[model samples]
Structures are given as structure tokens and as C-alpha cells.
Target: MSADHAHALPAGVRPPTYHHFEDLAQQEESEKLGMWAFLITEVMFFGALFTAYTVYRNLYPEAFMDASSKLNWKLGAVNTLVLIVSSLTMALAIRAAQTGKYSQVIWQTVATMIFGATFLVVKYFEYMHKYHDGLMPGPTLFFTDVFGEHTPQARIFFSIYFAMTGLHAFHMVVGLGILTWVLIKARKRYFTPDRYLALENVGLYWHFVDLVWIFLFPMLYLLGAHYGLGH
Candidate 1:
């Protein structure tokens, strides 16, 4: 339904219902439920990738380890830390929205976006380094000596790496876009304590994105380190 507000609302009360929703409470419930449902689907999608990664890792343990080591764990670790802090800020922004503190929401959202941007920037540099090293998997890949007899399997590992991390980064970029919308609404004082479900939904998305990274950091960067298997 179009977001056109009901004909009547008390002064300063944001319109809380669309035509299909019985009241503000119903609207809030529906929106929150919708976000949860969407998140469940995302969980299943990533689960498939995790399953594939695990199967392949078992099949070619050494090649996976070797390919993983070519990655800069230090940079991955920093991005992980950055995203953790961004999750904190996202939570703070949601809290601020709940408390009707528009100023806090604005600043907190800005902090979240800054941290997210920092992550993408770090990732950009990492991608560039790979490009220069020819570690990126494709027709032009040149890391044969590094993996010795396991070059082809190592290539497969990098394919999974790029698919997983690249997808994760793409989600972060989308989250940033959502944050931008939330920031704009915040500046307009569009959300009040009673009508901030949009902000809450955005928080859900931001947290989910961060959670994916938390898993990814270990899966991609910590695998080789755990067994003392790679340089």
C-alpha cells in the first residue's frame, strides 16, 4: 500500500498505519516480522556457501590452507574489528531512535557508515594487492608456484573466497545505502519512539551484515592459522 498517512493524526504523531494495517501496533508488528523473515532466508543462503566451503576444505585441506595464507589476515582482522564497532554504532543508533534522540541517531549512524566505509576501503586495497600479485582466480591467475602441485585446488579455494567475501562486501554496501536512508529520515525527525520500526528494521539488517562478517573472518582468515599450516 502507498505510505499515504491516514486522514487524521494528533499533532506531532507520525502517521502510524497504512491502509492494510489496523493500527500503529499492527504496522510495527508486521514490519518487524517481515524483517525477521527476510533474515531467515539470508541465513539459509549463506549456509549453503558455508556447506560448500566445508566440503571442499575437507577434500583439499592443504590447498585451502595455502590459498588462505596468501590473504592478508592482518587486514581481514582489522576489517573484522571495524565491522564489530560499526555494529555497536548501529545498535546505538537504534537505541537513540527509540529514545527520541534524533541527534544521537544522526551521529551514531554517521559513525556506523564511517566504519563501514573504512571496511570497504581496506577491502579495496586488499583486492588491489591481489590484483598486483595475480592471486585473484581467473584466466590470468599467476600464483602457481605458491601452491606447487595444488595450484588448481588453490584456485578453487580462491574462487570460493572471492564469492563469499565479495558477496559479504556487497551486502555491506547495500546496508550503507539503507543507513543513508535512515540518516536522512533521522535528520528530518521522521521517527519518534512510537514509530521507529523503519529504524529498527535497518538495525536488524546492519547487525545481520556484521554477523556474517564475524563468521567470515574466521572462515577465511583463521583457518590456516589454527593448524600452523601456512605462511
Candidate 2:
């Protein structure tokens, strides 16, 4: 048989295999499944931080409360609200993408990114305040004022607070990066009404981030705020 009849072999060119579904749909489903797996791991990752926090708080109630009192609940609460709004926007973005509303998806994604950035900015200010006040959790410095001279347990409280909040902030940064990629793809109109798994998975991730913050707010901020007193 001639070369043309022998599958038309070309240098460095490979024949494509026929898939049951089109490439785009297959890719979309695969991406969605991958995102769900990633979210599950994220849950486990944050779970460890929470467990550590619980252990420390249970061991040093007074020190924990003292440290918790120093946190600016007003700022934390505002951030919580910001993240909640972002979650809603992210979900809406997914819906927009599913309905082939490219403009809406792009705008909603931008809105979500803005809220994510706002959360980071607030967290930065909080960290700055803590650092300036010498509230770090260790013998390095600043524990005396934060926990009083006699209380050594304050270090533990600060340790857990830093661990939990810092981890959450890192995840927020990751989410922002993910959203940036999604925005680029959305701008290119890569997603269609029937194949928008990327948007949906990112929505799941956004909600998970929001959920983690919901738990963190109460655990790190409200757990020891005079609720356990006189019990």
C-alpha cells in the first residue's frame, strides 16, 4: 500500500484516537473530578489545623481567651461578610458560565477576585497589628504584654491562632490564582453552556474556602470571649 493509504504517517505526528465524547466535554468532566478531589484534600488539610487549635484551647482556656480578646472582631467579622459575598458571586459566575453568559461570567469572576483580595488586605492589617503589638506565640518576644508576665500559656494561644489564620490566608491566595486562570479561560470563551465544569468546580472551591472561614471565625475569635466564664 502507498504511504497515503498506510495512515499517512508524518514525522513527529501521531494519530488521534477516537473518544466516545468530544475532547472538550471529556476535558470538562475530568477537570471537575480533579477539583472535587483537590477540595477533599483541602478539607483534610484544614482539619488538622482546627484539631490543633481545639487541643490548645482546651488546654489553656484563660490564655486563649486573653489572646482571643485582643483580636479585632470587627475586622474579622467584616472579612467574613466579604468572603460570604465572594462565595455568592463565585456561584453566580458558575451559573453564568453554565447559561453561556460569557460577559456575566467574566464580571462575576472579577468581582469574586476583588473580594478575595479584600479579604487578604484585611488579614494583612490584622497581622501587622499583631506583630506591632508583640503578640506572637512564643518566647521570642511580646508575649508578656499579650498574656501578662505570669501567664506562659498565652504563647500557645497565639501559636494556634497564627497557624490557623495563616493557613487559611494561604488558601485564599491559592483560590485567587485559580480564579485568575478561570478568568482567562472565560475571556477566551473556552467554556460553553454544556461544558462549564471548570466554573462549577471553582465554585465548589470558593464555597469550601468560605466554609473554612466560617468555622475559623468562631473558633479563633469567639470561643473564649467570656462564654466559659462562671460555668
Candidate 3:
């Protein structure tokens, strides 16, 4: 594509060539590799937190179970379902972008944002419940005698729970912002069947966020299910 022709294309649709990239395929591959590299860093970051939680749970299994029992598993499950649906919609949005169906892309992305917002709303309620119960995992923490002398150990569990889930929620907010930006360009009639590198990157991120929750829902909420505490 010539300079004038490339400039004439919709801004959100990537050009067929750039000064740095040999061709559209090379540009697309570079973009995907960059996103994957960033995602690997994210995985390492989350992995450290998971490792810490694992060590603590192994050392204080009873305390972990007791603390996990107090969490609202039902709310966690609801959030899990919300994310699953959001992932589906996000995938559909990418497919639409690939098919050059701009309208479908917009609606599907909107569905993704709505479901993501729903997950956060449910999380807000859960946080408020814990806050009201003095279980927010801070200097104000008061686990009650329900946890007995294991309260201290359980405090560790709450701290990690808040850290992991709070980070996950932050990611959702960021993903929503990206989707909004994409939606704006989409409204302006951007991207063609072969020019959706940004949208593809966003899809990878949205799916990663959902995958994290998939691990979190079971690790944090369902650990004590057999004992009837998490159920």
C-alpha cells in the first residue's frame, strides 16, 4: 500500500506495511509476539502470588479452610459464570472483527463490558459484606471466635484473597477501558477482515483475565467444599 492509500484507510485498521515491518503478516506476527511477551510477565506476577498462597495453605490447612469457609462461595460462583459468558462474547467480538462485521463486533464487545461490569458489581457487594463484618484484612480485621485461635492464620488467607481478587478486578477495569476505546474506533468504521491486530490483542487479554478467575474461583472459594464450609 502506498503512503496516500495507507493514510486513506480507517485509522483503527492496521496498514499493510510499516517502515519497520516488511508486510502486513510480519506486522501482525510482531504484535502478537509483543502481547504474548507481556502476558508472560503477567503470568509470572500472578504465579508468585499463587505460590505464596500455596505455601501458606500447606502450612496452615485448617486455618485456610476455616477462612475460606467464611467467604461467600455463591457470589464467587456467580462471578465465575459472569466471566465465562464475557469470555464467550469477547471471542465472538474477535470473530466479528475478523469477518469484517463491524456491527457484530460492537454489540459483542458491549456484551463483554456488561458482563465484566456485572462481575465487579457482584464483587463490590461481596467486599462490602466483608467490610461490614470486619473481615477486610487489615488493622481493623476481627475474625471472631468462629475461627478460634486459628484467626491469625486465617488472617493470612484473607490478605492473599484480597490481593489476588483485587488485582484481578483491576485487570477487568483496564480491559473494559480497552474495549471502550476499540468500540469507539469501531463506531468510526475501522478494521477490515484482515486488519484487527489490536482487537485480537484485546481478546487475548480478556481471555487471560477470565482464565485467572477460573483458577481463583476454585482455589479461594471451593477449597472447603467437602466439609460443607464453601458450599
Candidate 4:
């Protein structure tokens, strides 16, 4: 919708509908609130997965550590760095929106997309390596080899691994789509210093993505530390 349409709100009355809010500030606030609420639910959603992962890891410490060792920590670490930088740039993009720096906002969002793409590229390689090794979610080659014959329980660990990481990666793709749209809108100056609800909402979503990785890193990569795997 165009700014002209935005100003067509009833006098002194902004609809509680944030996307249609006449007052830009009110819209931004509503967007932020809605984003936070959505993020809270996301946290809970991933939290359940994390809890299940933890329980399984505890159940088979050796198998879990062995599985963890199979992961490419170097790639994981680099992707973590990329995402952290992307989060910083995303936050800066929001600040740029607040200041009405349309070009800066567009570029920052573009930079974030690049970093996000890099992360996905790395993830692609990681997934490819695992798949080629037959380490997918199933009772097939993923087990019986990677986790050692003694560690049958590790198959369950890898199952959760694929499910959790796969879902997280899917969210990254969604965020990338949102950022791309925001970039186009920013380039067209759809967001004024007063009316950048889209930017604010996307920022909130991006931050939530980062937060999920914060938990995933420790849970997936660092969970088996200090455990005696007998490897």
C-alpha cells in the first residue's frame, strides 16, 4: 500500500491493525510487539526440540559425542560468525530505517542477505557431505556406520539433529525472503522515518533467528563435551 493510502485513516484513530496503522510510530510499536510475541512462541517451539535433544544426548552420551564429532565444527563455527555479523547488520539496518536513511537501510539489508546466503551455502555443503555419507534421517546408512555398532541409540540423536537443523535452516530461508522484500521496499522508500513497520518486524524476526542458533550451537555442537565416549 502507498503512503497516500496510509494517511487515509480515520481522524485521531489509528486502527489497532499494525500493518494498516495510520500513525507510523504506532505501527512500528505494534509491529515490534507482535514480532516479540511471535518470537516468544518460536522460542518455545524450538525449546521443545532442544529438550528432546538433551534427553537423548543424556541417554546415550557416548553415541551423542560420537555423532557430534562427526559434525564439521569448522563449518559450523564459520556459519555462526556469518550469522552473528548478519544480525549486527540487520540491527544497523533497523537503525538506518529509524533515521530515514533509505540507501543505508537497503544496503545493510542486502549485506545481511549476502551473509544469510553464505550461511545457507555452507549449510548446503554440510548437508551434502552428510547425505553422501548416507547420514540422513532414517534407519539406513546414517546409522550402522557413523555411530558405531555399539551406539545404536545414536541414530535417534542424528534424527533429532536433522530435524532441528533442517527446521532452523528453513526459517533462515523464510527470513531471507522477508529481508529481500524489505530491501525492495526500502529501495523504493516505502519506509519513512515514521513508517517502517516492515523493517522493524523483519528485524525482530532476524534477531529471533539468531537467538535460535545461540541455543542450537551449544546443544548440537557442544553437548557432548566432557563426556567419556570411549572413542
The C-alpha stretches of model 2 lying farther than 4 A from their native spots are 1-31, 137-143, 227-231
Summarize candidate 2's per-residue lDDT along 90-198 as a digit string, tens digits: 9889877666677788999999999999999999999988887777654554436535652567777777788888888998999999999999988876555655665
Scanning candidate 1 in windows of ten residues, the lowest lDDT window is 1-10
Candidate 1 on 57-140: residue-level lDDT in tens? 999998888888888889999999999999999998888767767678899999999999999999999999887777787765
Q: How many collisions per candidate? A: 0, 0, 0, 0
**Top lDDT prediction, candidate number:** 3
Over 4 Å off in model 4, which ranges? Answer: 1-28, 224-231
**Which is better, 1 or 2, measured by lDDT?**
1
Please report, as a residue range, the 10-residue window in candidate 2 with the lowest summed lDDT: 1-10
The local lDDT score (0 to 100) that residue 164 gets in candidate 1 is 91
lDDT values, one for every candidate: 0.85, 0.78, 0.87, 0.78
What's model 4's overall lDDT?
0.78
The deviation in Å at residue 167 for candidate 2 is: 1.1
From the highest TM-score down, the ranking of the candidates is 3, 1, 4, 2
Write down the TM-score for model 1.
0.90
How high is the lDDT of residue 46 in model 2? 88
For model 4, residues 1-231, the per-residue Cα lDDT tens digits are 234434543344322455567766666576678878888899899989989987887778777777876677778878899999999999999888667676788899999999999999999999998788777776554445655563567677778888998999999999999988998887776766556666778887888888888778767776555553221
- Using lDDT as the yardstick, the better of models 3 and 4 is 3
Each candidate: RMSD = 5.2, 9.1, 4.2, 5.6
